[model samples]
Target: MRSSYLQTDLLSEFDRLQQQVASLFGGFPSSIRSDRYGSFPKLNVGTTDDAIEIVAFVPGVKSDQIDVSIDKGLLTISGERQALFANEESDDARRYAQERYAGSFRRTIELPANANPEQVTARCSNGCLMVTVAKHEASKPRAITVQ
Candidate 1:
């Protein structure tokens, strides 16, 4: 009877370890199934002497479908990239997976205190969205002569 009890306990421990492994990786199938698609767009932000530059990799999305705005030092990039599957009414789900972040995306980036939001400019080229936020005059570096 003790040997049977030990075997049962060992099995339970193995099951628990399997669950821990799955959760450590990326959770279970149920968790993945409940996850949502079309997350907010990602960006690469940097700065220069004259302007703060932000580039977002958003391929397969047209320039007309995107909207860029700035409010209270927050720059927002929003867009939608429709799926390009050829099937008009095919019943097959997972048609090309549609994983290119389709159906709307929004990303807000905080601008520095010296950012000149009024002078911001945005352009999309070659599947990348580039935004230039001009820096305030006071923020630009200047040489000073020491007395």
Candidate 2:
């Protein structure tokens, strides 16, 4: 029937449009996810009146194993995580399922223009790696004097 033919054509057109839209978004990851979803450590970036705070959740990694560096306004955090079952190295003892991520990973964050890398400091405690970048003297908010 003529009506059935038009409906089929319309459905096919919608399917094609959907495929095109999905393809367009396929190249970009969602905001909540990264390119390598399980590779990099999760991070929280915030700011205070005095400094910018970057906290990286790095459980199971020793403080000495973690490295933090700032170069050209890019802050980098690199470290390694050991496997949960290193002693079970045999094929028969292989884990049927493992969700934990274990390996070397590196994450880089872009610091704001107000960030002063020279006054940066890093500390790791309670499985959190906190990096603080002081704000430039001129960047801090100032109250104007009223005559």
Candidate No. with top TM-score = 2
Worst 10 residues of 2 by lDDT: 27-36
Q: What are the per-residue Cα lDDT tens digits for candidate 2 across 32-138?
A: 43343454688999999999999999988999999899999899999888877765444566576544577788999999999999998999999999999999999
State, as a TM-score between 0 and 1, how close model 1 is to the true structure.
Answer: 0.68
TM per candidate comes to: 0.68, 0.73
Model 2: clashing residue pairs? none
> What CA root-mean-square deviation does each model show from the true structure?
6.7, 4.7
Error of 2 at 59 (Å): 0.5
**Across residues 2-36, which tens digit of lDDT does each residue of candidate 1 receive?**
99999999999999999999888775545543434
Which portions of model 2 miss their true places by more than 4 Å? Answer: 1-35, 87-97
Total backbone clashes of candidate 1, pairs 3 or more residues apart or in separate chains: 0
